[model samples]
Target chain A: MSSLVALLHATRIELLRTLRDGSTLLMMGFPVLLYPAMIWGLTQAGLYIDEARDRETLVLGVADGVDTEGLGDDKVQIVPATLETLDAGDVDALLAGAGDGLELHYRAGSPRSRRTRRVVEDRIEARNTERVDAAAVEKGADAALLAPLEVDVDAIDDATPLVQFLIGLFACAFVPMSIIVSTYSPVVELFVAERERGSIETTLCAPIPRSRIVYARVLAAALLGSLAALGNLGALWITVLHGAVLVVEDPVSLPFPGPVVLGTILALVLSAALLVAVLMSVALSAARTHREGQTLANFVLLPLIVPSMAGMLAVISESSRDVLFVPIAHTGTLLYAAIRHELVATDLFVAVGLDLALAALVLGGWMATLGPTSLIEGIQRPAWLARLAGES
Target chain B: MIEVDALVKVYPGHPPVRAVDGVSFEARRGEVFGLLGANGAGKTTTLRMLVTLLSPDGGTARVNGHDVRTAPEAVRGSVGYLSVTTGLYERLTPREMLVSFGRMQQIADPVGRAEQLIARFGIGAFADQRCGRLSTGMKQKVSIARALVHDPPVLILDEPTVGLDVLVAQTFLEFVETAREEGRAVLYSTHIMSEVERLCDRVAIIHEGRIVAATSVAALVAEHGTVEKGFVATVNGA
Candidate 1:
């Protein structure tokens, strides 16, 4: 009961401390407002890709006396020019007409050149198939009799292009980014910064136990991080809407179902709590100064970012019990699935169980490491020098 | 009263260091006991052990009848500690810092207690200002107010006047006298001979992690002409 009171006071102080640091506030709040605009601009990128794929064919320079009737798309204009002049840069491709075949040439590495080559080749192939069909018709044979097999395909995928993109980008990329921006300074400020500035000694001298102090700081960080995450998602929502109007005409919105959204938020809370405990313990363990704490917190980003990036990119999109066992990646995958409306009972259950277990373990480790003596000797050197110093 | 017996602390390293080696002292009710030493002479370490910041490897300390090792919470609840290294949270206002400390000490009506200390310390002028923006003297005043808000019966101050201007330092010295008069046992550590002469009823001179002398200032002056010379003589005699 007494520990609870001490924790409340400590958490209140920690939260107020973070609110006052101008840099921390800016780092957390700006992304929410700016990212939406950036997301809305992605529509232009899609338009570019679509335009690139279906462009009108440029003039295909042909040798004189080459019969070019019905050879390619009607929009493609045939021109009379020597292969060298055309190939040099005047046309999309140069064609040397043979008796019944053609040789096509284009620039070696350009994407436009590759597109021209594919178009010309496809035109010739289509012509060849047409000739075969005409010959068969003249022989009084049905064209459908040419092949024995008949195949039909019925395809269904509920995810829209934008929805897929969001799900793919969410897990590894967005979650960890939110964690980093939201919790980094506060974690350092609460634990390592206190120790560095020598205020930790004063806090330790209080009648409250060190465990309560650790609890208060961790909870405070988690609460702030959760707020940042919700803000990020909210910004992402508005941005996606902006992108819909600008990038896709009448793009369908894929909102997570009400329960699913709440569950994802709860998952974010758990993952953030786990991250805070781990980072604070690592920071307080390895750092003696705020600068050193910042460096250590950056190192923590390595593990958080890599797996989450993989998940968000759909490099590992398949959900399973095994995936749920992983820490940050699990949170990312579960959140992605929930957003895509593909989340299932087992995925959420496993995610909750796994994250809670990890949080407990990390928090327990932090509690074990916290003490007056450890703070007095928290770390002898910067984390970077520990290896070098150890060898010496 | 604060009682300490043969307290020891050995810091583990390439070659272990005995930071405080079997030190002992006592500060009785209504007395200001001074522990004087050079830097790294175990004065802070001994005080830290008493305040329950660092645990002793051997022996024990008791503040207000609470055993430091077994009943450290009670010891902390009973004693207020101040030191040069003890700092205020820079982002919090002086009032917030004091109220937070009061709450930690589980004071009823913590805000009211903080208000009283704020007025007593003349902190009302800038009590709402964040500590980081405060002048050094103002910060010192806040730190003092924070320590006193809990109204603990014992005070352990380690160089609490290290950076204060002479005038503010004098104000703090007067407060110490007031605390002593209220029958609060004060264990004060410093190397400043003048403050020690004015405040301490008894003096313990520590050298190289061990106590070399423990006596009243008058007896030391009778033997060595002054507490400053007595400190030099005691440290050198060891």
Candidate 2:
């Protein structure tokens, strides 16, 4: 009971320090402000380019003996010309040939030339349909029978491909990356900065065991990581998806993930934060200063990002439970599935269980090295680490 | 009270160095004991062993009747350790710092004890101010108060006045004297001859990793004409 109380007191102190740190606040605020500003800027740029494309008029050249009764529009200027004028850049596009072999020619590099080609092709297609209908009626055949078949392919009930990709990327990559960024600064401040300022020696002299100190510090960092992940997730859902709906006018259905999916997402985020906190706490314990700690953490955490990137590209089937064995990749895959509302209960269990297990294993081993000797004289390189450097 | 018997600490390297070798001393309640040494003389190492911060490789140390190796937590709880390198939390206020350390020590009433120390140490004026914003003298006072918050019976101070101005250093010496008068065993470590002459009841002059002279300050001064001369002769003779 006394140890519990001591742990609580220690945690409170760590939390107070973490909350007052300016770098932590900035890292937490990154997603909230960056997403909105980025989306707004992108939206404005897209709208401006589209409006400019719509306002500009393009010159279209009609070759001799081609149908030209109805082709001009407010944005297209019809002109009589030969292949010479088309090649000389006098016209944006050339509508040449006739009958079943109509040819539309344009400069591929010019934006206005491409636009003009599309407009001329559309007009000619409409005219051809009319003429075909008229000819069919005169030949005593049904005009309706001449209509071309149309097919519409829908991947989901209503969600577009762009929306699905955005949601998948945000879940599999952004949230996890935010959690990592959030967990980093606090670990450095708590472990390396304290050592640099000489406060760690004083804290080590307390009656409490070093394991309790490690636990308190890890808990504080994990809490910050989880909160930052949630903030970034919420900000992403609001700024990007909702903004897409309002601007794109595509009947975009905002994904209201079911309760199960929501719960799984929360679990994945918390477990991931816990894992990162434990990993960083142990890795940074060897560092003597903040700068060194940060550099070391960057190298240690680089491998975790690969799983998230792979999850973005991988299409895991519902029956493929083998993917759950991979540590962080499992979380990323589950996150992608959960965002798409296809997550299975068994997979969620496997992912979170694996994460917690890894965290426990690291914590157990880290506790053994927390003696005063290690704290004061610095931790010696383990045999495996030495062998990894070819020192053995 | 503190008792150290044949304390030994060795650093394993290309060549092993026995930083503290067969050093022995006893500091009873109501007296101040000084460990006088130069750089690399193992003064800090011995103090760290007493406070349970480092384990003696081949010796036994007892603080307030608790053996360091057998009951390190108890020994740690019974001693208040302060050093020049000991630092306070910069983001925490003096009052918060006191309460935090008090709770870590498992004091019965941390808040109340923190208040008492603040008032006793004259830290009430800046109890609410952050440690980073305070002057160096104020920070040292807060550090002293933090060390004593647990009311430990033994106080281990290792070069606690290395960087302080004369006035602040004098104030620290006065606190050491107060701790002695209050029936606490004070283990002061430094190389300053004046501090040893004025504050120490018994002095141990250490050379390399062993004690060369252990006697009362008055006796050493009488024999060598001054504490400085006594320290030099004792160190050279060793």
What's the DockQ for every one of the candidates? 0.62, 0.70
What TM-score does the first chain of candidate 1 have?
A: 0.64
Please give, for residues A175-275, the per-residue lDDT of candidate 2 as tens digits.
77777888887877887788789987788788877678878888788888888887887778767675664334345667566787778888998898889
**In model 2, which runs have C-alpha deviations exceeding 4 angstroms?**
A58-165, A246-262, A315-322, A369-377, A381-392
Docking quality (DockQ) of candidate 1: 0.62
Instruction: Judge the docking of candidate 1 as incorrect, acceptable, medium or high.
Output: medium
Give TM-scores for every candidate, taking all chains together and pairing residue i with residue i.
0.79, 0.82
Regions of model 1 farther than 4 Å from truth: A1-6, A40-161, A164-168, A251-260, A315-322, A369-392
Model 1: residue A263 alpha-carbon error in angstroms: 3.6
**Candidate 2 collision pairs:** none
Q: Pick the candidate with the highest lDDT.
A: 2
Clash pairs detected, candidate 1: A43-A247, A168-A312, A172-A308, A172-A309, A172-A312
Chain A (alone) TM-scores for all candidate structures: 0.64, 0.70
